[model samples]
Target: MSIEHMEQMETLLPEWLETSRLRTGQGEVASYIPELAKAARDTLGVFVADSQGKTIAAGDYGIPFTMQSISKVFTLILALMDHGEEAVFYNVGKEPTGDDFNSMIKLELVEPGIPFNPLINAGAITVSSLIAGDSPEDKSQRILQFFRKLAGNDGLDYNMDVYHSELETGDLNRSLAYFLKQNGVLKDPVEDVLSVYFKHCSIEVNCADLSRMALVLAFDGVDPCNGEKLIPRRYVQIAKTFMVTCGMYNASGEFAIDVGIPAKSGVSGGILALVPGQYGIGVVGPSLNSKGNSTAGVHLLERLSKEFSWSLF
Candidate 1:
């Protein structure tokens, strides 16, 4: 039952889709953000890309959604690349919070304002401030450019509607930024950082585009499409290690045990999971389980990893 030995993985997914799609029936879409609540609850999609940039998918794979927290991975990598690993880690730690993504209790409990990891909202905001740009516009443009390179799609840009929606209700995040500022941990102003952070989160993409972005991490930052070194190799290993250990908020450890793939989950019900140097999978089902991850997503990935024997451990 190894993916390498499986003769027809490309043919098995649709049947799996039919059987697995219904797992989303019981879960609910994230309603915290008014825009996020509008996602089609039953809209399930899966896209996978191999090392050679080949792909296969089923269901609503082409339907577009915001990158949400999944953008954390790319931005973290970009910050590391521009500032060097040592500089970036000074502001963010590599540990998981075991709390909700937007929780603020940590900033008080973990003094001096170091974010536990870049996967969480507080940590992501800290990471965004390290992107090596002096201005918000410069920093955001740099983030989008890096994304375009990894996704092979220059058309990527922030969904203004989602950005505004998030910005309007981002009280907790604003508090987190101010906390960092008080401790001298934040490099940019809170207003500027929020602008960059919100824009990155609002960047739109479908499952296919995300799978390709995962492909960059799969190959350790090398864009296999054109032999371009899109991200530094060491930075990617760091990002992937965090993804495996803490990518799914509080459920990260369980996801690692069950799925055994280096993966990241966004609030938009999208999971970007990849097998290093082999393949990458993108799954989206807007209905979230108690862990704030897609309900069917956790189950489907566990089954796929077990059947295919692709555990990193």
Candidate 2:
């Protein structure tokens, strides 16, 4: 992981951001979540945290936004930490569903009702149930602990408004939860599991916080700042494997081809990416492409990976 370091990529990031923002107009913001759609569509930003803990950024990198689906990565890792790998994988899978990120049809089509991968909403909810907890509050605390550990910030908190908003409008997630319950894949009650899942989805952070979290994964679960292991190595493997395979919903394959890095994206246009064993990258652009990935975020990553040769493959 040793490398020459840039004091800050922020000074040069704006030029890179501007060049990559051309695709924002070609895509639409997510309207399903309602609140997510109201974000400034034209906004695009990039933030990077290297192995040295140096921060760099440009554009709307400071914009506050809910983690949305991006939080699933943390929850999946948390569930793995609570339950062993075998227990986690038994309920969810590592392969991509290739359907929309929010597609319920995949749940119906997959036999025995196992989710195609933990990055999807259905899979994430299933993972949420595996946390060692008897109540929703108990389960959520485990997640918060994991997030705080990785983000290196105890101030990270759930946005109750966003959580309630998703709860009020989450018919699809509710239906998926019930489906998992009926199939015997859910460990907790559907409502309880969904509560934890939605709350994780509603965790709020700006791009800088996200890069710190992403950097943990980039460093293989070790927080470079203190050289401490924040996540188990085995569970880190599972989380990143899923990110490479299913992180961007249906656009994962295309992302792999273009960006050549393991990455995750949310409906809020936040993407967490990495060059494993190297540097972690984060991007935000409220507008999303057809597959619910950040439009400019995609372009920015593609160009960054190309310019820096950051592919894991």
lDDT of each: 0.86, 0.83
* Residue 232 Cα positional deviation in candidate 2, in Å, after optimal superposition: 1.2
The parts of candidate 2 lying over 4 Å away from their true place are 1-11
- Model 2: per-residue Cα lDDT over 1-313, one tens digit each: 3244353245556888998788889889888776776788899988888776677788898888888888988888777777788888889877878788777887777687788888888888888888788799988987887788788889889988778889889998898889889999986778898899999998888888889898898888898889999888877887888788888888888888888888888888899888887677878998777788888898888877776777766
Distance from true position, residue 287, model 1, in Å? 0.5
- Candidate 1 regions with alpha-carbon error over 4 angstroms: 1-7
Clashing residue pairs for model 2: none
**Residue range 139-239, candidate 1, lDDT tens digits:** 99999998887888989888898999999998889998998888888967799999999999999988888888888888888877788888888889999
> By summed lDDT, which 10 consecutive residues of candidate 1 come out lowest?
1-10
- The C-alpha TM-scores of every prediction are 0.96, 0.95
89 in model 1: Cα distance from truth in Å? 1.1
